[model samples]
Structures are given as structure tokens and as C-alpha cells.
Target: MSQTAPIRVGRIGYLNVLPIYHPIEAGEVAGPLSVVSGPPAELNRLARAGELDVTACSSIEYAMAAKDYLLLPRLAIGSRGHVKSVLLLSRHPVARLDGKAVRVSFQTHTSVALLRLFLERRVGIAPRYESGDVTRALQGGERPDAFLAIGDEALRLADHPDYPHRWDLGSVWLDWTGLPFIFGVWIARRQAAVAAPQAVAEAARALVAAKDWSAGRPEVVARLAAGQGGFSEQAMRAYFEGLVFDFGPREQEGLAVFFAMLAEAGHIETAPRLEFLDI
Candidate 1:
């Protein structure tokens, strides 16, 4: 890429991240940035392929490919508890779903891993896992015993009458470990950071500025995000309020615990050291 070329940044196509991306999209934070939007899994793939210079991707993806990326400090998508978005909807109790078919969303990697840890380690039930279109299945009135949903889909299906039992993965993890759950984090590709240090730093600063701008105006952010996921303004406000956008000490500690558990459970080969960009 040319030195003058714009930095290609990946944005997660979920309302949860609107506060960060909306400002950048609206030119509130100025930088030579070209934004690409996609689901979490797609963003992870692009980041792994070196297609995106900077991106907010699944937390697990960062660990799996930590050598290729440097974390952007003070930015993450996490929850102290009750993340309302990442949910496990089931017809039966989670502990009783052994051997039953539970459809998992293909749009997720971290949530699926977390769900596995929850069921096998915490709930003590191993359900048959299959990858499928959970939203389509639910819309078509084809209810499997259970299904995992994340992002806007989870928010939409959170109160659906068909599934009486809903488990918030964030809350479940918090209860199990007494730590926050970091779903996603902003990262810069190592090559990008090394090749265009100033560009990467500018992009990182723009992201922090955007977050700061959104911090003082939750109602405005909520209003902007309303209807993007069929959620009311009030609901969006509450959802945004529940999310933690800072990658502080507590969030890092929580992420460390999660990575350790993922390694212990064989979901990952090994726990990775969190590598952050100096800028």
C-alpha cells in the first residue's frame, strides 16, 4: 500500500459498536481512514488475512492471532454483567440440554467458545452443536431445542415468546468468574503499525476521540442507533449503558482469565500475552 493511501479499518456491523464507528462515519473524527463493515466473524477473517489495517474483532481472534496484531489500548466491547446481546435461547434449562441439537450462529467465534465453556464446564451438559442460520430458523418458526444468538439478532430474540429460557453469556461468565466479559477489542495489524506508524496512531487517536465524544451523550448515541436493530431508543440507551468500551485494568484482567480458561478447555492452543500498540 502507498504511504498516502488511507488506512483500511474494519467496523463490526452491530449496534453495540455504533458509538465508535458512527462518529468516524460522520466525519466527527478526522483521519485518512477507509472503513469496512461486517459481522464479527467476517471482520476476524479479514484481520487475520491482513486485509484490514485496524479493526475491532472478537477477543478470541486477538488471542488466536496475537502475533500478527497489536491491541489498541483503552478500547473494547465488553460488559460487567448481563450483556443482553450474546444470549443462549433454549426451550429447556441449560443443564438439561445434553445430547439435544443446539444450533450455533456462524457469525460468532468468541461467543460460541464461551457458550461451550459455559455448558461443558459450568452447566455440565454437552449439547450437539451445529452451525446454521439461527435468525432465519427462528423467523421460519423452526425452533430447535436451543440456539446461540449474538449482536442485533440476540437483542431481537431476547424476549421472543418461543424461547422461554434465555441465558446471557456475559452474566453467566461474570457469575462464574466474578469478572467482566470482553467480547471484542480494537487492534492494529503489526505490519500496518510498523509500515505506517503515524497513520495507525492517528486512527487510534480518532477512535479514542470518537469514544470520548460519545461518552457524554448516551442519549444521542442511543437515538442514532435506534431502529438499527429494531430496538427502541430507551432500550438502545440501556444496552449502550450496560456495555464497557474501555480496556482498562479490570477489562484486561477479565480478558486474561478468559484466555486462560480457553486454553485450559482446549479451545485455544495456549494463552497469549496481550500485546498493545505503544501509541
Candidate 2:
């Protein structure tokens, strides 16, 4: 596929990203693109450094880089309510831990931002925040009073009896804004689109097509994703159920609300204008 040589794409390593990544990674969808897998944070940095031409990045990353990149149209990882994958795990209820420190995962930045917004704006609890050591957290090492965990680990933590108090970040956002919460958006650097417009366009089409592919046969995607993400097939199917893979008017409204909240919280000077690659 020399026609589109040197097209680099970043795939998020988490299970939630699999519905979109599976086609590209498995060679089912043909593109003259190379795929690299990493957590959302890592992929965000790589895309910023220009190592990746296109990727599904944390929603916050897209906002921060909006001027430098154009979002790929009609693709996102969002949830309406009760997203089991993004959770606040605490030994005690969140309201009761006012003076305690809240540890957070370093994987996805969107959930971190959402958690902060929820705690401060809706819940009215201001706690000290620190990055949780994911490896240590999983192994029962030094523990904090509360921590934000996203992706697969959060899903597992939801059912664990030890963490009695848990809050779904997506549900919290929905309660606060009366809108679905978007965690990640597909994006491509402006230079990549300028240099290889057709490649970039084709890649977007393939990604949107991937969503349709998954919707038509979720069980196939589920079994394949279960193998890739090392989760039970049932669990994978359940996870897919909560994720919104398409971008429509409702999802757009959610993004606007999130951007507004970020601006309101002094995260950005001005909310970014949403731009998409021409399809």
C-alpha cells in the first residue's frame, strides 16, 4: 500500500477502544497505515509529538490540541449513564472523605478531568489529588482513601466487594449536565491531513465503518476483543453495550457541554471549535 505509505495510527490499548481498533489491527480493513497501541495518555503524547497521524485520544487531549489537529468525524467513545468502566473507588463514601487525598489513574485524562469537575461542582468536596500507581494499586500496595480508575481495571473494581463505595463517573456527569459523557474522540494532526488528505479521509471512513461492523455483529467483536483484552467474552460484550461508537447530534451536545465545563473550570481560555476531516 505504497500509495499511503508512512501513515501512522495510534490505537488505545484498553478494552473500550477495541471495537474501533480491531478492524485496523487485524487487517480486516485495508489501509496504508501502521498501528501502534498504547494507553490514552501515551497515545496523546505520541500524537502531540507527531509520531502518530491519527488516533482515538482522550477528549481532553483533543480539546488541548484542537488548534493543531482536526477531529475524525463520527467516531468517539462515550456513554450515557452508568459507565462501569470509569469509577471512583473509595473505602468510604466520597462525601465523607472531604480532607482525604484522592489517587487517580494515569491512563486516561478525560475521566480524571470529569472526576474533578464532578467532585468540585456537583458533589462539593475538594480533596487533595495525586496520581495513583496503577501497578501498585492493582497489587494491593500503598493505598489512598479514594482513587479514580478507568478502563478494564475499573470494570473489575466495580464488582469487587472490598471497594464498598463506588461512583460511575459517566453517571455523575449525566446527573450533573443531563448529557452523555464522551471520553475519547478520534483525531488526526493537521499536517497529516494536509500531506495525505486521501489517506486521512480513507482512515476516517474505515473507522466509521468499523463501528457499523461491530454493531451488526457484536458477538464476533466481543469474542475477538475478549481474546485481545484478556477479559471474559461476556464481560467484553457488556462493556461494548455501554460504549457509544458513533458521533451524532446528541454526542455533539455532550462534547459542547464538556468543553464548556472545562472552560468554566479554568482549564482552557476558550472552548475549541469542533472541526472534522472531510469525508
User: Whose TM-score is greatest here?
Assistant: 1
Query: Deviation in angstroms for 187 in model 1?
Result: 0.9
Q: List, residue by residue over 50-110, the lDDT tens digit for candidate 1.
A: 8999999999998898999999998999999999999999999877899999999888899
Inter-residue clash pairs, candidate 1: none
Angstrom error at residue 210, model 1: 0.5
lDDT of all the models against the reference? 0.91, 0.83
